[model samples]
Structure formats: C-alpha cells, structure tokens
Target: MLTETRRVARIVLLDPDDRVLLLNGFEPRNPATTWWFTPGGGLEGEESREEAALRELAEETGITDVALGPVLWTRVCSFPFDGRRWDQDEWYFLARTTQTATDQRGLTELERRSVAGLRWWTSAELSATRETVYPTRLAELVRTLLDEGPPHVPLVLAPEIV
Candidate 1:
C-alpha cells in the first residue's frame, strides 16, 4: 500500500514565568514584519523527536533542562521553497523549563539566522500582537492553558458541516 510517510512525535517547552516560548523572524521570501513562532526545529540525523526538541531548544534559544509534554498541534504548512511548494509537517508541543535564559546569553547563529527575535507573550498579549505565526485555534488553546494552568484540558471542537 502506498501511503504518505508523515513523521509524528511529542513536543513541548516552557519559559521561566511559565509562559510559552515564541520565535520571530523574517523569511526573506515572506513579507517584511511577518514574524512570530515557537522555539523548535527538525530532528537531526538519527535523532529522536524528543532529542531534536531538546537540541533545538538549546541551539535556537540556549534553553535547557525542560520538562517535555505531548503534541499541542500538528501543522501541515505548504509554502514555497526553491520555487516549489513544499509541505512541512510540524508538530508543536508543550513543555516547561525551570530555568530561564538571561539576556547575557545572547543569540546564537541558529537563532540569528532562523529567528529575528524571541519573546514571551502572555495569552492576553498574544491577541494584541499584530504579528504571530500561531493559528487562532492554537493561540486560544495556549490561552486556556495559561488561564487554567498546565496539563491542557480537552477542548471540544465544533464539527464543520461539509
């Protein structure tokens, strides 16, 4: 049977104040001022999703020793890459880090190249932020987590009429 080989796994990471971490950047291809996303990346060769999340956290934000959790959102991003529309299956997660990075740590090449900036935004602030890559549904989920506390409660989604 020919089937799509889609990757799957759990991803999660948190901030010092318990706020989720978000990344901001300008993809040369994308319009200017369109920046905002979580801190994470693809797994390295032979690396598990968990390992990749941990590694990406360090490489992108210099964050470490975090408590990882289940998948919050699995996004199928279809965008232009090298003049071709490439599909990216990204799995977002929920995690918590006891320690936070100080400004002294500074930005690394991965961060500088991939991310224009990083900021911790509360659920309320997220709505006001003119820029963010998070989907409205995902943002609402995050807001719920922040308001009610961790261990995201199950949310009932309204069924769409075909």
Candidate 2:
C-alpha cells in the first residue's frame, strides 16, 4: 500500500477534575477492534500545529472554549485506517475545558465513519482499561503529566504502529 505522510496535532484535553478526554474509534476495516486516543487530526493548509490542535479539538469533540497549553509530547507512527497506509508525525499538546458534552456537528464524513465517540477518563480509568491506547503507556504518561506537570521540553515518544 502507498503510504501518506501526515502532520497531526493531538491534545491531552483535561477537565477541572483532571480527567482526560479520549476518542474511541476503530479502523473501518475492523470495527470489532476499537481503541481510545486523544482529540486531534492532521494539519490543513498553512496552519501551524497549534492551530490544528485547537481546530481538531472543536471538530472532533465540540468543546471550543478551551485553554490550549504546551506541547507535551511528539511521536511518529505508522498505521492503516480507512483502507490507507499512513505515516504520521504527531504532536501532543495540553488543553483544558470545562464543557464535557460533545457535539459531532463538526466531524467530517470520514471521521463520522471511523470515530465512534468521545469520553472523558480519569487516570485510574485509563490505567484499568484493557483496550488499546496510542502513544503506549498513556495512563503512565498522563499520570506523570498530572503529577509533575508538562516536561520542560516536549518528550520524544517511541514510534507506534496501529
């Protein structure tokens, strides 16, 4: 399969209670297998990663009144979805919002097909879930972020294949 390289911006969106919001989704080819991930997507046009982060948050989760924060991590990954091979460079940023309700009004048709829905999860929940999560050890990373705050520099995470 031909691989498409994409630059993606992801957010670790948290609520006042320190719970992180995750998107539940599965590859179109394999709906029986689903995974949870943060809210974000590929950059469009000339928009920077920051702009993409904010836009994706609203589009994917419908929470716009957010305080977008620093880039917490960066990762490179290869995954197959929607019948295409993708090589993605992802940046994970920190963001906060009080509104937990999500509106799918902004999701693209493709998104609607592949993305199941959004749910806010506490660190403990993240830790307990047997489902797959991207960026690996997400619960541990989130725990570190919450306990010690964002790193002085964005950490480069090991590549992932999904």
Model 2: per-residue Cα lDDT at residue 82: 85
Q: What is the TM-score of each candidate against the true structure?
A: 0.71, 0.96
Clashing pairs in 1: 11-93, 12-94, 12-95, 13-95, 14-95, 23-37
lDDT of 2 at 64: 94
Identify the runs in model 2 with alpha carbons over 4 angstroms from their true place: 1-4
Off by over 4 Å in 1: 1-12, 29-33, 81-84, 102-111, 147-162
lDDT of 1 at 125: 74
lDDT of 2: 0.91
* Candidate models: Cα lDDT each: 0.59, 0.91
Model 1, 62-116: lDDT tens digits are: 6777788766556555444333443445666678887666241445553454456
What digit string (tens of lDDT, one per residue) describes model 2 on residues 54-114? 9999998889999989999999999878887789999999998889888978999888888
